[model samples]
Target: MNGTRGTIEIHLKELLEEAGLSKNKFCQRAELQRSQLNGYLNNTITRLDIDVLIRICDTLDCSISDLLEYKPG
Candidate 1:
């Protein structure tokens, strides 16, 4: 193995779970496009739009820190 391989990850699924929100309900409540939300949940998103992130934070009553975590390899 080489050096450290790690990531600062968005823990969207866990936050959603803690909030008791289903994908569909969250989309409707947060006014997020279904595809975008799906992208995040599935970890298939390449870029996260800041506007959308703010909207989600406001809607969920969570700070950005609440949705993200840092892990070491």
Candidate 2:
């Protein structure tokens, strides 16, 4: 197989906006640090934590697919 990999995009910012939630509020509700959330928002997180993903999904009442999208590279 080729070494190509798809990108995993995080739509946290858009989701938060759609939910009418501020970053600070979301961080508080998700029990996440502002910097950590910022990493996800900026797409700079190298690793995806399942617990964090679950927290975000639970807090936003959204499915994993709503928060992330995989695009072929």
Candidate 3:
């Protein structure tokens, strides 16, 4: 796979840090699994289900932009 194309990186940890929340609490509030959270943290996975994304945004009390970021090649 290309290093950049079609890849999405999420700054989930950074956002959570800014919000002063722990991973466990954030995951609980967001209703996301540990594996899914790890994937976003490690940048090893792309694509989020709409439901998950919505939950995260809701938990963070922010828009999608506040929880996620995009880098393009």
The best-first sequence of candidates by lDDT reads 2, 1, 3
Clashes in model 2: which pairs? none
Comparing 2 and 3 by lDDT, which wins?
Answer: 2
Model 2's alpha-carbon lDDT is: 0.91
For model 1, how does the per-residue alpha-carbon lDDT over 1-73 read when each residue is reduced to its tens digit?
A: 1126755677788889989989899999888989988877776676668988887888789999987666677
List, residue by residue over 1-73, the lDDT tens digit for candidate 3.
1154544567678878889999999898888999988887786764567898788888888888776665666
| Two-way lDDT contest, 1 vs 2, winner | 2
* Candidate order (TM-score): 2, 3, 1
Tell me the whole-model lDDT of each prediction, alpha carbons only: 0.79, 0.91, 0.77
Measured by lDDT, the strongest candidate is 2
lDDT tens digits by residue: candidate 2, 25-63: 899999999999999999999888999999999999999
Lowest summed lDDT across 10 adjacent residues in model 1 is found at 1-10
Cα misplacement distance, residue 22 of candidate 1 (Å): 1.7
